[model samples]
Structure formats: C-alpha cells, structure tokens
Target: MTQDEKGQLKALLRDEPSMRLHRELEKELRDDMMQRLLTVRPDDPAFAALTQFHRGCLHGLHELWGRREQFVKQPIQGGNDDK
Candidate 1:
C-alpha cells in the first residue's frame, strides 16, 4: 500500500465511524458481486472466461476485506508489513 493509503487505513482503524463505513462498503461490494454473478448465463460462450474473472475478483475482494478486518481488529503499531 502507498504511505497515504496506509495512513488513511490507520486512521480508519482508530475511528469508529470510518470502520462502520468500511463495513458498509464491504457489504455493498459483496452484494454487487453476487448480483453480477447471478446475471451470468451458464450456456453463454463468454461464461467460462467471465466466471473465471469474477472468481478472481471475488477472491481478491475477500482477501482485501479480510486484511482490513484484521487491521481494524488489531492495534495499529507502526509497521510496513501487511500481515
């Protein structure tokens, strides 16, 4: 993450309002992904490629969400490490 992004994340971790907003954002993203996945047709030629792309997108989103949750759960100490 960039230094500015890291600083913003730290600020979010320390602020309840920002944390709540993050949770809401995550929920919205997940819901939107689900909607898009549901719209994909299994018989379409593009199905396989689209499915693969969606899977990767969801996986990345989940990973980032998990990381954010972990960051918020733990106390913010000065560190560059993501995990």
Candidate 2:
C-alpha cells in the first residue's frame, strides 16, 4: 500500500468500529491461513489457491474499510453535529 492508503487506513481504524472489526478478523484469518498452509505440501495447488483467496479477501476488506471511513466522516442529516 502507498503512504496515502496507509494514512486512510489509519484514519478509518480510528473512526470506524466496523473497520476495526474487519482488521481484527483479517488478522485472525491470515493467521489461520498461515497455519493451514504449513500443513500443506509445497506442490499442492490447493495451498496456492488458499493463499490467493486470502489475498483477495484482505484487499476487499481494505477497500471496504476506506469506503466506510469516508461514509462515517460525512455530515449527518438535519444539520446534526453530534455525529
């Protein structure tokens, strides 16, 4: 990720509860993937597919997090300031 992407992720993590949950879930999934991959043989195609799937999942989670952050930062309706 670029520095700007990193900054956006940090901001999202600060303001969005769902983003925090996503990051925690992603960390757990990554750890589980690592453990499962360790049991697979090097030549196994399933192992490669699993790794690729996790990569895609992480990428999607990051994109969602960025969008959610932008959403949360937007002004609320009725001219509310409490949000």
Candidate 3:
C-alpha cells in the first residue's frame, strides 16, 4: 500500500468517528451493488435503508477526506528515495 493509504488505514483503525464512517461505507458499497437491481422496479418501501445508508456513506467520505492530509502522503516514485 502507499504510505498515504497505510497512514489513512492506521488512522482509521485508531479513530472512532471513522468506525461509524465505515459502517455507512459498507452499507453504501452494498447499496451500489443493489441499486441497479432495484431500479428495475418502482422501488420497495423496505429499500429506504439502502438509500439512506448510501447517502450517509457519501457524507462520511466527504467529511473524512477533508482531514485526509493528516494521514495521506505526497506521491513519490519508487526509486526516488534518495532525492
């Protein structure tokens, strides 16, 4: 993994807010997969959770990304460490 990804993951592991974030994130990921299938119909009332979960995931990612610099690193080449 890139340092940025590693750092972000580490931070996420250490952080609580992101814990909740991922729950929504997971729901969102699942929702995306279901959305297409759901689209074929007018939509079931029970599926509201999917829409809410997906929206919440987007909200979390947007907020978390703002603080990403705390963990994210600048991109560098594999052979440029000496520079």
Clashes of each: 0, 0, 0
Best by TM-score: 2
- State how far residue 35 of model 3 sits from its true place (Å): 2.8
Q: What is the C-alpha lDDT of each candidate?
A: 0.70, 0.77, 0.66
Answer with 1 or 2, whichever has the higher lDDT.
2
- Tell me the tens digit of each residue's lDDT in model 2 across 1-83: 69998787677557667656877988997998899889988799988998898889888877776676565556456755566
Task: Tell me the spans in candidate 2 whose CA falls farther than 4 Å from its real position.
Answer: 1-13, 16-19, 70-83
Sorting all predicted structures by lDDT, with the top scorer first, yields 2, 1, 3
Query: Which numbered prediction scores highest in lDDT against the true structure?
Result: 2
Q: Listing every candidate in turn, what is its Cα RMSD in Å to the true structure after a full C-alpha superposition?
A: 9.6, 8.5, 10.6
lDDT of candidate 3 at residue 22, scale 0 to 100: 65
Kindly report the root-mean-square deviation of model 3 from the true structure over all alpha carbons: 10.6
